[model samples]
Target chain A: MKNQELPSLNYVFLLKQTTLEQPFISIKMMIVQQILFVIISIVAFYLFAKKASEIRRNILLGRDEDLTDQSEKRWKNMVLLAFGQKKMFKKPIPAILHLFVYVGFVLINIEVLEILIDGVFGTHRALEAPLGSFYHFLIGFFEILAVLTLIAVISFLVRRNILKVKRLSMAELDGFPKRDANTILYIEVVLMSMLLIMNASEGAIMLQEGTGNGFLISTMLAPAIVGLSPESLHLIERICWWGHILGIYAFLNYLPYSKHFHILLAFPNAYYQRLTPQAEMRNMKDIQNEVLYMMQPELAPPPPADGSQPATSAFGAKDVKDLSWKNLMDAYACTECGRCTDACPANTTGKKLSPRKIMMATRDRLEEVGTNINQNKTFVEDGKTLLHDYISVEELRACTTCQACVEACPVSISPLDIIAQLRRNLVMEESNAPQEWNLMFSNIETNMAPWKFSPDERDAWIHS
Target chain B: MLEVKSMAEFMASGESPDVLFWVGCAGSFDQRAQKITKAFVQILNKVGVSFAILGKEEMCTGDPARRAGNEFLFQMMAYNNIQVLNGYNVKKIITTCPHCFNVIKNEYPALGGNYEVIHHTVFLQQLINDGKLVLKDGGAFKGTKITYHDSCYLGRGNGVYEAPREVLQALDVELVEMKSCRSKGLCCGAGGAQMFKEEEAGTTRVNFKRTDEAIETGANIIASNCPFCTTMLVDGVKNREKEEAIKVMDIAEMVALSLKDQ
Candidate 1:
């Protein structure tokens, strides 16, 4: 190594030197670059925060619900479902590949923290001295993870495009949904490549100086670039460094607009997952009260002193706003993996019902409502609701409510909840049920059974 | 003929039975389901377990009504049934219908009716576990191929997968499993009140698809735990003209036949 001194402002001379002792850039240029980095970061974060708050406000537009009970169990669910990826293990092949990308993406971001600090403070390898040999080991481990992530991403891209996996290539994913998936894969490829190239060029400079950091994968590629001039190598390193950081910032902001937002929302979604038995549908308390008032008049609350009639709440959800916040959050947290649709009995039998589409439609309608609020300061009726507008009556009617979709969701989303609610609206609000269901309902109302069999003969089975 | 007592008779005698045998609508009215009701009653009698049926007082539990999206009707039925149940001071219930078991156990509590509701498969497993019920060695079903079809309400609905299989194990029959069993078990297209109405347009019926899976197992008998599943699977088998080759029988009926002392 050369003398341990801060390099002076001779850019060409500094670039020609192959010593690891000096900072990558001179102090004056470092200060200028630091300011640029700060501005870019602030802008990126500001944009992300703005969109994030809008999404929060949109989610809150849903009807009030209390999912905060059982905090201990909720925390366990968050850890198991989000952190542990327990449900993803249902399918082992993709699960293993997904584990690679998920673990790699998360662990490699530790190196980003160093890049961030170096960007802000004009230092090179800020964690290197503090962490000592451990820093090299950490970078080497991250390099191995990066290579694994690369392989996973490539296979995922091929599965989505070339081989066209059935669940992924479904018609609901046509147009922007398809593009969003492909774009995410492409972004991962670019980010991982930029990181590798930056580390390789840096390793080449260190190799010439006999002070390599011994990053596992990149050091092997460093020799290919060793023949380049020192200045050229340094230029390549700086360009890749800037490219990688900028790409990360861009990806961060893009998350709120893409299905990849699940990366952020999955934790809260898991924490707020429904803890009830899948067999139990949420009771209609309003209907219960309505019956109570009629059955036992003593249990009914007295009328207002002023004699104004109480406003009757709507029977069930007809639009996104009528749904619970957890349901809306489920929409945003959906990975569009289509496991729910694949497991749906109606979909498997070739009915029009696709549970994945239910989530996507909910999200799309919610976005439209959010934009309406943005422009008009409040939602002015767009004369459209989530029920008949986005999802069809055929789709809603086909569901057996067997909870296969709920059981199949890796993220604890209950598309059945949304389906049941919409069906309630269709029946009670619009009286749009099939004639056979109408007969059955009336039979239960009158004869106390779904069929017209007399209650008198309920125990006649003993005679047989 | 076996003598069956009613809750009214027990009440008039100044005594309450040990458990209320809630014969659901299907068990009461559907001819095919009536056999399951009879088989379960036979087991209860053979074991000397005191049980009483509501008889004339029994009504629907509103499982289908609620699932069919008629909340008003469902609540009315549930309210009236709760009144009857609470009046009788019923403590525990055993039902041959998974739908009734699920609704009364899970959905009725909020309406102020709570009881320890046990499905018959689970009850039979308990009976066998306690040694109150014993299977004959090499009974009629011994070594017979029987594939148990999991009911949606019983299996994934309430996680009562093992009790049915355990009961089958007690029978000493070869319990073959379908490709999808337990938590991943497919529905028989009879849940969510789909039993009453026609299924919406699809390329194939849900029950037909499920029955094909069951038949593909090559089990001579497709054993079921729910009345609705039994009805749907039977229809599917009949549709494919495989009813003669593949028989759909409830677990209770299987147990009633294989009883050691029968």
Candidate 2:
């Protein structure tokens, strides 16, 4: 108390005043609520994780011949990229603020564990006395960080609300949720602030109640609680605590279905990043050899019809299933953070392609894949492919494959490979590629240069 | 790890040469680029270097084609070039165009194309290092505050920013830099096959922005390496109406100055 610390949280005093704090929560209801929390969480998390794994296997229908080499390399880079927050670091303000929120949220999980242990195990005074100092210090620091993060999020909202929301309509593209989306984000932030204040208020109530075991901030709020009776103070604590836990519950459940789905995808996606630098163009085998192989289709054996192709099919993703496994995981890890959209030359230049949309498209395709998995169907089984239906040919062709998205991706997803594979499928398999590309292909074949020169003229540019 | 044992290993399989030079597409194809290349060759020959040519056997190094989203075309051209080079076992590579140099040095390896690649300016600088190359008194470039454009392929692709600058620096001329140069250098609208494809429809091409940055320095001589950059910037100069005051030159063209007295 003499430490000149901010008012400490008098958790012990608040808990001891069972008459007021425990109101409406009979022992029977408490037991039922605890059971529901445990059971529901276990089932939801299990289903989500299991569904993710199942969808992954179902989608990874294509394979590169050098799968081992490509995969191992991608995995290492993805790890570095996600854990290091490399892309976030590219934009300083949002990145640092996000880092604070991210770390604060993660660290706050420890406080949740403490609450559960004390609440469920009757270890109320157990950790409090022994880890009191350490616990108090962390809670204090986390509250301060939480407050800062709240402020950052509030400004983010105002910027989006008072400023960016209007600009959204004038942007070259559409589909951005105008007011409704911003409203939800604002609500999320508001809820977070409420949780912090409630926790801090509880701390104050304890300190003012003369609970020597409280932390500085909570204890400081103790004086503020002096005006209220024990009953009212206790009531406030229960309301805040329940609201905080429910907020956490709702957030976890809703997150899997959100654009920030990268939260779940990031870990696995990082472990499966593209091993190759996007700038280094990979060389396919001899053109004549490919033509010769294509001519002799009898010699080439298609794999068993389990929907899996032979790994050596130099033919790139002939369909959605042809994408590498990591590509599927990458769709999940995409935070939709818009760094790629911001950096995209095509998008910035008013081209139809937004790298952000491409990532989102991939995610939606995966969701479609998830839907299709139980039905034992392929992405292209119905002549209505997920990619063709989701992303337009113009958007696909618009990509220069400059690896801007690859470079911009914080999770290290190789969108270029996916796009290139789609191109391969369009050009080679179906002849459904854009007319311009077909002409360009013909020009290169006939004239060696797309400039429509003679084959002999290829070398003429050398001496001109 | 990488070394130029001798040019004779590829050219004649044992005959030593005073210098090994690489003549790239721009040098061989484009009229102005050919002029610069020949001038560079003339200077090197005058310095007692016995050089050889790949002649008509060379196709596009696949730099432009591949960057433009046509990897299929690139591989075809690359495969042919690799076979041709290994046929002569061509070693000790040198190039006039930084784009060609980059492909020959870096991009080729993935496609089985590897050689001891150096841009012409670096080779010229080496000749200076060995005290074999000497500058002619072309005088001080008219005190033109020259701004250097770090070609994406040359500077960022292979980290060859200094060699070209060294050639400029040796001339005792003014050397101003673009705001965005070197690793962070903006593209001149030629990268990623952009030279072939229509540019993203915008008020100005990215290269136009780059050229403007260079022009901001008020330097008359805008230096570049890759022909794509040179072509774009030269047009930028004319369209911007700075042509009367500004000119674009390659490092090879500049190095030819050292041999001007030849």
Candidate 3:
């Protein structure tokens, strides 16, 4: 068998011959496999699209913000921050490991495309004839990446569970978050193993046919399976192929419900990132108008002839719907990596405010609102809000607005924006500020300073 | 005493100064911060750069009110200040407070107030770069171990980290850096209206944490740019009872002391 010319196409034909004794039966089996693959792919994509549109709808429920300016700058930000993973390099060790997994995930999807084509058309190694040796090189590179991905996934799992990284194990990640992170890691591990095993099994049979010399990493494992009966080897190969494809579909649907959604959303989040200086909190234009109207009564809009007062907009965000759409998108784009929490001055100093938790709670509440909208075809008041129900006054007050968390975020999600809005609602809408803050506000209003000093004495420093 | 002119005084004389020195509330009233104002003014005067203060016309930039969530008061104050500033045709302004610098430069524009706002450290750095202000070799700060504190508003807030450090570099001092400086620099616990109210309960104060990092560098002087950070670090030093040995001086004060005699 080793002495045969053994063209790559002949290898697939032989694979079919060994799997089914009769040609007619093998052709029938191929049709059945094709139909099964098509049905599964349709269902997986349908479910994914359904959840993804629902998420889109939920994000759009937020107040509109115009982040469309500077298209070139936004595109550059997306390329550098999202595609390049520039911020991740702040911690070099995990960054390198994560890069291996990230690059592997992207590159291996090309192999997935090949698998899809094969499953749909009932043809094996379809790209081999056209590209020839480059195809062999591609698979070999993918095989090496698969092994690296496996190592990275396992290291991540150990870091999360055994090593117990402080950020990963924080109380905010207690139940579903913890499980979601580990589950994603475990899924990657299984998926990469399936790919490796499938390649190895296929390489083993190809070696017998004298056509498998270039599957770099898989060729090593191919020998252990070389002694298996041809029937068993073909069955193993088919099962791994189906498992790898199905597992990918499962992962796709799971993304809408997991922190792993950042993989898809990070690009758009980076593009829509606030492009102002970090400490520049957005001005309240409505409040400015109100002050203007007060200063110049002629600027105020006249009352209706029916004597109804004009509807005033609410001061700041009290719930998810009040937040800007970008804020909601920021929530969904969070990777749950806890880098924000780790860098939070409030959280690091034993305060209740974790910027990561702010993003997470915003996401959770937004999801709940989305579910409510899904059930009633419109959001009904749930008698709870993000301000008081999800985030506490203590947590909101603890923020220094230091921009540490904002700077620390790898994906450019600003938890500070949401925090500022919520804090605005707390103070402006509810007048719920600390006694000292209230005193400070009053002094500023009356004395034109935070302290109880006379405006007459503002220049006293000059004479002194 | 230096005869500091006000914008009103400059206007009455039918002349506008080159810049308006925005003596913030802290610089005007806070006793300790007044020294920073005087030092900055002395630098401007020594450089023969004509500048006037808003003096009694200057109001709070409403930074504390806005950060503490009182946008109404902040806007009201902003409106009045913009009126005064615009009335004066103030094209360029300089200040020693980062909070004021951040608000007036970044936040005031939307309310119809725009100016070329420069933080005093950045202004001093410009003066040094332009050769208008020369530092004496082996000045008072020479041979001293000085660690520059990157104030939240001035450093990460506005990306003005290098100017203050550059000003420090010109002092012939050994400028040691804290463990986290520049973009990763820790807050002095005085931002976001934290100065006006008590900090939320925590294991330790943020300023103490920041001050400890500065102390860990074994620097005797913790040089800072923002007045709020100066007060916070001063208190942090006092809490550690290291006030006798350690000093928190503003960059302006350092520059004032290190200026070459005419």
Q: Estimate each model's TM-score.
A: 0.96, 0.80, 0.97
lDDT of 2 by residue, A1-464 (tens): 55543333355455556565454655655677567666655765676677556656644643543444566666665656666677678668777877766676677667767656544543333455777688678777767666666777776677565766332333432454344345446645765665565665666666565665344444555565656655566567667666666666566655566655576577666665545434555554544345334545675556588987545553555445667666666666665666666655566556676776766677677676666655765444555554578677666666655455676677767776677666655655566654555565666565555445454543343234
- DockQ-based ranking: 3, 1, 2
What DockQ values do the models have? 0.84, 0.26, 0.86
State which candidate has the highest lDDT. 3
**Which structure among the candidates has the greatest DockQ?**
3
Share of native interface contacts recovered by each model = 0.81, 0.14, 0.86
The CA lDDT at A375 in model 3 is 94
Question: Candidate 2 or 3, higher lDDT?
Answer: 3
Instruction: Provide the DockQ value for model 3.
Output: 0.86
Residues A227-269 of candidate 3 have per-residue lDDT tens digits of 8766667788899999999999999999999999999999999
| lDDT (Cα, 0-100) at A262 in candidate 1 | 93
lDDT of 1 by residue, B166-231 (tens): 989888889999988888899999998888889988899999999999999999999999899999
Candidate 3: segments with Cα more than 4 A from true spot: A1-20
- Span of ten consecutive residues with least summed lDDT in model 2 chain A: A165-174
